[model samples]
Target chain A: MRNRMNQRQECRLTVGTLTDAMRAQSLLSASAIRSEIVGADGVRERREGCGYALTFSCLQEGQVRRILREAGLRRF
Target chain B: MIYLDHAATSFPKPREVLSEMTRCMRFYGGNPGRGSHSLSLAAAEKVYACRRAVAELVGSRHPERLAFTLNATSAINTVVKGLLRTGDHVLISDMEHNAVLRPVARLAREGRITYTVFPTMLLEEGRSPARITARLARLVRPNTRMLICAHASNVCSASLPLEVLGEFCRKRGILFVVDAAQSLGHLPIDVEEMKIDALCAPGHKGLLGPQGSGFFLLGEGVEAETLIEGGSGYHSLEEEMPAEMPERYEAGTLPTPAIAGLLAGIGEVRRMGIDAIHAHECRLIAHLARRLSYLPEVTLYAPQYQGSVLSFGIAGRSAEEVGLALNRMGFCVRAGFHCSALGHRTLGTDATGTVRVSVGYCTTEAQIDALADAAQRLCRRT
Candidate 1:
């Protein structure tokens, strides 16, 4: 249960548009860093014009950012 | 079967197109720009090559300026909906396909923009490019923001003088957009030389690729609002669509396999040469026109401006009836309005659309003979 709770601790990465968010999600998934598209209801303030966010585990935030940077993605 | 509806979509795509699409599906069935893996990279590379090929075909300076869409309609919609603002005006030709007409018309209906259909006489035979340019200049209004016209009519196959129009638009600071659905691979188009602002074309038609593959190439200093906004694989933390070339317009997962096929199709077109293909289709049209002209019962529409397509009507038979009779004899021809009510209106055949026989790269003299013979017999029976 504790491990499950830890895995559920999510962190969001906001992108400029929906296309970039999807791209970031694809990169994260390929790197084995699980992520989900958070709806505008969940990340309204953080959402860019695309109105979505890639939510991954807090533990994977560093790695996700690194991967996105390596892929030449700009994060908000 | 003799497939003469190349205007609708080219049948029997080049062998390389099929092979390349199959190879991509089997070997690298990965989402492009989605990840950094080898499969993703490979898919991205193939998609990039497709863009590059399209850019090269149109003489575009940058491959990144091209955005792949589902078809020419979608590409045109991206420009029409994204470029024009409320109260702006546009100019189009009377010979435009619905692909160009409907979107612009809808905007006008919604009271966002107003448009005028330039008279067809501008494109009529014997009108020099200079005269057409001057006539178009007269049609432009102070609010005229853009001019959109098809490179060639899908119904009557009337080739528009795009270079002259492009030059006129450039001088007037009016954006020039071309719907190259019928002319992309059948005729040579130089976006740079023509000063074209944006060009839209379908890969499935003249390019000899599968359906669901089309693109829009943008010229320098031209930008439009994003029509469909979603994940673009970059600038992931912004609340707005990215201010980029293709990523600004291309959203969601692209059709990868179809794009792969389109890349090969472009390659084959390059190898065969567009001029050769155009010459062959023109020859076929010329033969068909000559034979049909001898038929007293057939009224050929715009036969003098024959390009790759020929439209005609029988005296006693509807376009549909003649099309059906020809189909029964195993010749595929498109009947009815050919999705261009505006074109039919110009041809005075809006009520009874003309039968459109469009030839392709693979269409032969023998096929043209067969079509002519079938039409002659049908005319006699009627």
Candidate 2:
């Protein structure tokens, strides 16, 4: 479990608003991509306006971006 | 205590429902689709799961088509006020509860729409489906835009022939709306099989969920005007509400705790199987009907087994008096018109509405026997 956790990386994706961020999270979940809202100090410093960020595993980063893009979501 | 008022709202909800609701309030306290934080994500997951559960219960392929509402009244209002336009005619059965009747009546009184109420006698048992279909066929006019009916009457438990009506509507391109308030969890409803355009159901009744929880299931190509518009947490920049399935209908902060409870309630229903619950309730209804029919002074309004509800009155005593006596004997039953004056008018009980005893999953055979015995005793006093 430690090795698997180490392999996972956090990726921050900026959304238009908090709602959009949540919608993105739901879409990603439907595609079996596990993600959570970004809460680290570095991520908080990066959040702009009402936009928010999320983190996911590095292995699923590509698939997550692809799904978010298909859902008309943009990354900061 | 024998609580036979399931028709109003189910009591003693499944243990899982209460626990799940408490968990939601304590742990997942976030507005669904309002934020991207972990708590919000968890809350969103619970809401989506609830949507899926409601969709599955009503046999809808697209869970997104289901929209959460405050109750069945809101659901029916969303469909009625949103769909019916000026000069659009509607056909409804005379057995509808006030939830459906009042709104439609208000619209008719406003001259926005004209409605006709068909007699429930056509759908009575032993009546030929062909004859009933023919009668409904003649009632349809060129401007008949929709046919709305309650799946089962709250007053007498008389059920409408949905399959026949659905087929009739499909052939005529009329929208078929069903108020499944009393029948959702008690019977099997297949939207596809019945060609239902929309279904309005409450979670607290047969679904065994908390009050203030219900949903409106919209079939494909069915669209209704937004009843209340505000923040849907989507398309924030746009001044207009998003033209989407659920978001278009759900326009405010949803009751997350109630929805969580509804998810657990649906889970319990699925686990027990709708057929098993129906069988159990039907057995109780049959037993109660048989025993009540034997009393000379007890006038059973619905002597035959219709569904889970049984309405009766004593020959000389008013329904309220009997209901009070039953309450003194530790029986909780619904008295009066049951908010369904039209149904009482149909049953010729508009002057003296019958007492209603509605059974649920928790109701047992012993309770039914006790209720019958109490009714017999009340009759002897009269």
Candidate 3:
């Protein structure tokens, strides 16, 4: 019983550590996206807060268009 | 031809309101209360200034006593959920919006608090304030801790005589909460003179602000528990919520751009003057109600001297049918119960509901004329 409890606590700690790392990485990448030029920055950056996941690389134009579309931006 | 649903959400917000919101989005864009840098400080200041403006408008001495919520509904919930415990009794009015009724009803069903509702209509139109005061004086029980009411009805725009109600609550040593979502910026409110313990209002309705901006003002010495406990950026060591007024009530990141828009909106309202706006809207509403009453098929609800809102029914058509017909003619008005089901039932308009036409500061006399013409045409058609 003691061993099982210890394993659960270790698993929780591991998950928490991973979450913090992901948050830090996203924050850094979003800043890079804002600062970097629109095109030719192969790593396409995206700005998202809290519960967002980066499924595509920062440099993908298709992914950028998809993100903008999903955000309800329209062509005038 | 007209948009007469200001009671739901005011349209065509002041141009400066949009510009200020855009400016916040373009620059000084930072999470308020999250950092001590210049950008964060500017964002925080923008929010604080709005709190101060709201406090001054409502006659609150301290701006920090106000807390921001998504809307008055959530603000009322935050207070109702935070304050009441098991076996507590409350007093309410017959004209309350569901924002107050639903939460209180649920709590009553849960056995947390039971309540009594008083009818303000007994006072009559142009009735002396003392009549309403006498009615309320008879309703207060020993166990009653709070008396919450809508200062103005969204359905009919009939304003409750707050001076009498406020004094009644004061003399009984009970707390009084006023829902001012419909009349805060459009009508002059003096919380100090009114003896209002708490007021919940939405920024989008009469304040000409963007969506998701609203606040609650609590009187001194009336502290409700914090429902959401998290980082308020004030204390890093403490695990529990802070015991401060707004800081304790405000948890997590606030909508900074919304607050910026709210500050700009309040400035425009202050420049125009709430009394002037109230007079303008009342004139338009009274004109529209008078014209509608002249139509043989029209059945107007509430007195002709109500505020900016007017509710009516066509003898031959459903409220929804008439509303849609008006909409087809380029008019926008709200139909149905307006979220006051119990009140509608009490008034015997539950089945068909009432068509509501509410005006705002930007609403012109010509628009009211057009609305009256549309109603005439619809009546002719039916």
Candidate 4:
């Protein structure tokens, strides 16, 4: 079937596209609510939006003890 | 497995049904009229094709005249809520399920709609046709706006004399609505031929489809406004709902996969032919009823008008007891009111209820024999 407009223009909205848009909106909301960032050597971590992230991979054994004490908690 | 509950919902759906539904879910799974993509267009086409197919099956002139619903109950609700208001009267048969009966009762209690229930007349053996017609004509009232009846009784499988009732409604200008949940794919129905203004059917039942799919055929001149509102995909710019036939009634997202399965089910029915299926069920009912009559303990409810169901009660045994015993024997049976309290009362079996053994197209002679044997064993135990 030939239309006055191009093939893509002729059909702007279809079933698949609408469902994709609805699903995308849902994913975007989740992305905005919580976030996590990772740095090299498994050494650094950051938490965004709601809570704090504790980094401990490359720190000395004694340094971890001091950080836990300052946060008012002990690691078993 | 022996499937005798096809009257409730057909089991062992045609292989094509499952395959086609899977195809829709995999390749064309998209919200209809809600997007702009190739897959979405395919999904919309599938839904539209089903609508057109269903409309043609029920003698609807236009596909848009019919509206898809969750089940027959939902369709009935749309009609009851949208069209009826305070002071209007709705008439229904005594054989109605709680789906229709309870809603009407609530309406009556709140003083929204004055409702009347007409009795279902039974025929005597060797009775003439004229006697049955006269019995139905007496129920029509001047204030009755709608006359709702089941096409066939779920409790007894008695085929109603809708042709005669249709004539009565035509003369009185009453809107004749049929609750076709029990009859729709098991029996041939043409709304125009039967003078039915609206027909409600469950897709999961006789239509041999998934549970969430059902549609109502709206006859000409039945002006039912939408019971719900919001997105209809076509007229998104309009703040108000669409004024078109189906779009007016349909709001929000439709169950695409279920409707796709329903369309496939209808296609299977078309191929096998509904008349052939009906004939097969009638034969099964006849055989079952005849065998049941031989047992002294069996109390056949509707011996004269056995259609697709054979409802009976074992003397001295409660319906639930018999149902449990039958279940242990690998036979499934439904007992109690079957959600038709009025039907039970009208049949004079409300106190004890009755064991209903309904058959469908897939029911075989072996299953019927098993049912008869199970009843005999139960009868002996009682």
Candidate 3 CA-lDDT value: 0.75
User: TM-scores for all candidates?
Assistant: 0.83, 0.87, 0.82, 0.81
lDDT tens readout by residue for model 2, A1-76: 0012333355555444444455667788888888766432343333332334566787786787678777666532
Question: Cα deviation of B76 in candidate 2 (Å)?
Answer: 0.2
Q: Is candidate 1 or candidate 4 better by lDDT?
A: 1
Higher-ranked by lDDT: 2 or 4: 2
Q: Least accurate stretch of 10 residues (summed lDDT) in model 2 chain B?
A: B120-129
In order, candidate lDDTs are 0.84, 0.83, 0.75, 0.72
Write one digit per residue (lDDT tens) for candidate 2, span B74-191. 9999999999999999998888899999999999999999999977672256666577677788888999999999999898767888899899999999999999999989999999
Task: Compose the digit string of candidate 3's lDDT tens values, residues B267-376.
Answer: 99999999999999888988998899899999887645568888899998999998899899999999889998756765668888999998998999998999889899
lDDT of 2 at B362: 89
lDDT of 1 by residue, B1-382 (tens): 7899999999879899999999999998788766545686578768877887898888975776789999999999998888999999999988899998999999999999999998757235667777777677788899999999999998876888888889889988999999999999999999999999999999999998899999998887789998888987655675787787677888888999999999999999999999999999999999999999999999988888758999999998888988898889998999999989889888888999999999988999999998899888888797
**Model 2 segments more than 4 A misplaced:** A1-76, B122-126
Fnat of each prediction, in sequence: 0.06, 0.09, 0.00, 0.03
lDDT of 3 at A23: 28
**Local error of candidate 3 at B111, Å?**
0.5
What stretches of model 3 exceed 4 Å from their correct place? A1-76, B122-127
Off by over 4 Å in 1: A1-76, B122-125
Winner of 1 and 2 under TM-score: 2
